[model samples]
Target chain A: MDKLRQHIEDITALSDEEYAYIKTFFTAKKVRKGQYLLSEGDDARYEYLVLSGIYKVFYIDEQGREFILQFAKENWWMSDYEAFFREKKATVFIECIDAGEVLVNTLQTREKLATEFHKMEHFYRAKLTNGYIALQQRIKLLLSSTPQERYETFSKMYPDLGQRLPKKIIAEYLGVSRETLSRLYSR
Target chain B: MDKLRQHIEDITALSDEEYAYIKTFFTAKKVRKGQYLLSEGDDARYEYLVLSGIYKVFYIDEQGREFILQFAKENWWMSDYEAFFREKKATVFIECIDAGEVLVNTLQTREKLATEFHKMEHFYRAKLTNGYIALQQRIKLLLSSTPQERYETFSKMYPDLGQRLPKKIIAEYLGVSRETLSRLYSR
Candidate 1:
């Protein structure tokens, strides 16, 4: 609950009574490495805020290739957002990369909190604003950057993720091969 | 302002009084073809909502190659959002392809409107949510799709944009050449 309060307060202040009410909407769960938090065609009913460890949100192509959308870390949120927001089946999968914990809440909780508290709405808006900016940067990089530039940009953007994850995973995220990542690393 | 009302009401309802107050924050501007609404290094202090016209939001690389971030059509909004939200100088250019009109608003106006009305906050959050989903799909397409597949997907996703835009620009958007796009069109 302290972590939740801290995360929310990072963007907007919440009174003690408000924080108490907000805490009731979230449920915490422990995750195991290699566990699937969400899978394609599942309900996609909930989004999780990482308390500890790492998770990757991705989708598998027709050829069974995985395209990583995002790697969520502590205080970060992850979900098949399109599905979650639309109340549809999950289109992407969220897999735990490291065993840890997450605070989970359903879309109902999100809407409820947002409706009940203007600060919560503002908090959500701020988070989305940052997420939108990051995604736009990703698009800009994809449109123009070379593999070397991609590696450098990714490293600069998510130094923590780059250090924690294997080169193979980084390559997938960069749309390059593991050997290519190895070469880049050496350079 | 009717169009603005319609657009906002599509997401959340607003009273006549609220619409009157909201409309005061936006200014109408006529755009000419070949005009630059925003350019790299300029202050991107405002976002434009297209009344009617086509504009390309893009950036040029060191090699003088252009990468388009998005096309703005009627009811669409465009800006160097990273700069717009962060109050930084523009890192991209927005050039008008077709002459038309737009309703413009500043970040301060946006904040004021959202803070004044809960429905306005909901309206903005909903728009950002959709934009987030759209950007995520773009990333997924960039991650795995081939040029041909990109063309098809682009067409499927934005049929109006495909129909309205020239093949050369579409090729640029798909990260392919005009000849490649022509070949795809034939197929």
Candidate 2:
């Protein structure tokens, strides 16, 4: 897709021929709202590059409580990465929050692309670097930030997401109760 | 050093000539106990690969409370990655808990190595993948796990770290009070 080529180009340039070859590794799929891309116990065979849509990556606990790990939007990548990389069954679920399209590639295809094209490897490495930094910030926020601070930081960092996401889901992501989120909203 | 070469080789094969060139990008440093590799407001230019030693990556909050983000031992990489990647001042601290040696490489050097050698890029990407999964697990623990569950999981995951680290540090890492951690230890 053009979006995929643009995303890759943001990190590394690719020739038209190279882009054509690279595009073959990915297959596009349309997802409807509430559609589950992955769920616990399924083989996490593909990593997705979002073209347009919002999705939630989450896990259900022993008590059936849901914990949202992250939200992926356009140009974002999402999968049960632990499972995907290790060739294991999924321990998480990825559900489409809005109808949209995504390009999916298997780990084998990803590795092949990276190996065949040095630029692709560079692009993936760069993306991973950004992902790693974001995760580090998430850990810091979880460990040190107060609920209000967390809400404010989330709002500031993802103003668009804040406006688009339901308060209930936002509360879950912030690890705050709905009532607390409402109170913060009022303030 | 040999350790660095071996670390890289674990993920991808490299020629002696390649390893020789790769080693030049890294500088070895011996860290004394209680020495700070990085501190808040300092330029976070280099990422360290621990050769031998224990280190804590942490930050002190406005309330003067310390939060441990991660602990690095041999063969592990540590940095104020958010700052290091962004080429900005650090908001976190990395300090030696036990005297050890580290291989330090600047952002420029790291990028150069990755760009010059596709194998190096693959190695870095694999490392980031593992780190990303670990952080995802940490987020899951923080969002859903009880304190006791956290303590048990940490102990199980890093039994050596459980024995090597101070109870206070472990408590901070788990986001539990010292007394609570002690109680968990007793149980």
lDDT of 2 by residue, A1-187 (tens): 4898889999888899999999888999999999999999999999999999999999989988888899999999999999999999999999999899999999999989989989888888889889988988999999999999999999999899999989999998888778999998788
Candidate-wise lDDT, in order: 0.91, 0.93
Q: Residue A104 deviation, candidate 2, in Å?
A: 1.3
TM-score between predicted and true chain B, model 2 = 0.98
TM-score of every candidate relative to the true structure? 0.98, 0.98
lDDT of 2 by residue, B1-187 (tens): 5898889999999998888888888999999999999999999998999999999999999999999999999999999998998989999999999999999999999888888888888889999999999999999999998999999899999999999988999999999889998988788
Which segments of model 2 are wrong by more than 4 Å? none
TM-score of chain B of each: 0.96, 0.98
Candidate number of the best lDDT: 2
